[model samples]
Target: MFRSRTKDGQAVTKVTEAEPQQIRDPQAPKGRPTPKRSDALAQRRTLAKPPANRKEAAKRAREARRADMQRQRQALAGGDERYLPARDQGPVRRYARDFVDAKWSVAEFFLPIAVLILILSIVPSPQFKNIAFVMWIGVIATIVIDSFAMSFRLKKGLAERFPDENRRGAVFYAFMRTLQMRRMRLPKPQVARGERP
Candidate 1:
């Protein structure tokens, strides 16, 4: 069904119905209304206020920087001179030297020595007291001797290979290489646990 309309001798049929007007309730709650300008102004005022205590923030930042610098200095000086002799060798050679010099390889070789030391240190048995002391001395001596020999060997090797290269750069590179462990992270074939093939 449609309503017919006439204008300037032309007739048109309209099928759509007009939407009903919205009815306002006089007794409706005021909470449903849009926010006023005062609310918006208050929000802007809060946002525009300066942050509290700039001095404390600056002091904290300076302290953090100072602590960081101190740590860096300590790390730089702690082992630099001690490791200088082996600073330019290849990764494998350097690691091998380090392992031997530190007498860590001895521990690897003599598992029983470590176990004995552990047992002696922890157990209160009187019979094994002397044995523990002997093992401790032997381990300590081995580590010291190995470290000195390895350092000497490393220095000799570096001198032979890099006769003209700047020793400082070589040393720095070697130290960084060893400390950062860049070589160990390289992708390579590895023996997986329980793998037979």
Candidate 2:
């Protein structure tokens, strides 16, 4: 082994000539050892109990799903925005809904009129039948024209308001909402008729 003289004049062995000492790794796992395979299997087996009957298991599962849906609907209705469905959660969609809900449209009356027309068409009176026929044509024509106009305005508004947003289905969504009677709109109207968005 080579020796080197230190500044104090005493000879010291070079670090390269000394044997290295073992050092423990700081990241090494410590504490309780892993369980045996049999022990692990036993633990897993005990964690969950199997249902005794298929019908009971199914009923329990159905109840769980029902509860989940109810919670989701409540969250949406309460405007807990985080829990809203993918299509309805974003600011652009919310704005579109508000825009449509704020205005009055012929399409908004479509559902009730369509139902009335169906009832009128089935009546025994020829007068009712003729009225229903004329009404149906008028309703269809009015809805078609109004839907076009609503969709055009809605698309333009969404573009102006949310230029960075992906508005792929926003127009269709607004159009569908317009087709429903105002009072029956889901996630019910936040703004009253004639209110500005």
Candidate 3:
């Protein structure tokens, strides 16, 4: 502010605070559009500053992917449905998993049995190979029968529990779960073997 001397030897001045400018970021939206809950959470959780260059942007992307993978891994081990894949989501899927995990299945042992048979067949003797072949066939038959039986039971249980719910792919989902050893099951078993789901 400046005061100027007038012809009358008096100083007159008008003083007022300067108004601040409302600076808006060109890249920022005027209003945020609605986003999915998960998308919103992810957006809110990102770094405050934007990447300055292509290299930085790529690095950020890699970090985000790694974090996502870590969360998924934790979810699989802890059975957090929020972080689980689409294939394992929903009440019907959860019930199927619980049902399958609550009981033992011959299919779960297929991996170990197959390895044993493979080693047996590696021997030079023809008889050894024949025995291995027979064992393999038996294991295959047992796994198939066990899977079918489990699917039937799962279908019935699903019908009773989730009659009007989407049960599509549930039997297959349960069947895949049955193939994994109880110790290795993704979304680690919520129910212990022989424990009623």
TM-score of 3: 0.72
By lDDT: ranked, best first: 3, 2, 1
**Whole-model Cα lDDT of every candidate shown, in order:** 0.50, 0.83, 0.88
Residues 88-191 of candidate 3 have per-residue lDDT tens digits of 88999899999999998998898999899999999999999999999999999988988888888889888998889989999998898888998988989998
Q: Give the root-mean-square deviation of each candidate in angstroms.
A: 22.2, 13.2, 14.7
Assess every candidate by TM-score.
0.33, 0.64, 0.72
Model 1 agreement with the true structure over 2-115: per-residue lDDT tens digits? 656677766676645575456789788864466789988976775586446898667667876887766555433443322323432344434333433332234333456777
| Candidate 3 clash pair list | none
Ranked candidates, highest TM-score first: 3, 2, 1
Please report how far candidate 2 places residue 43 from its true position, in Å: 21
Model 1 TM:
0.33
Identify the leading candidate in terms of lDDT. 3
Q: What's the lDDT of the predicted structure labeled candidate 2?
A: 0.83
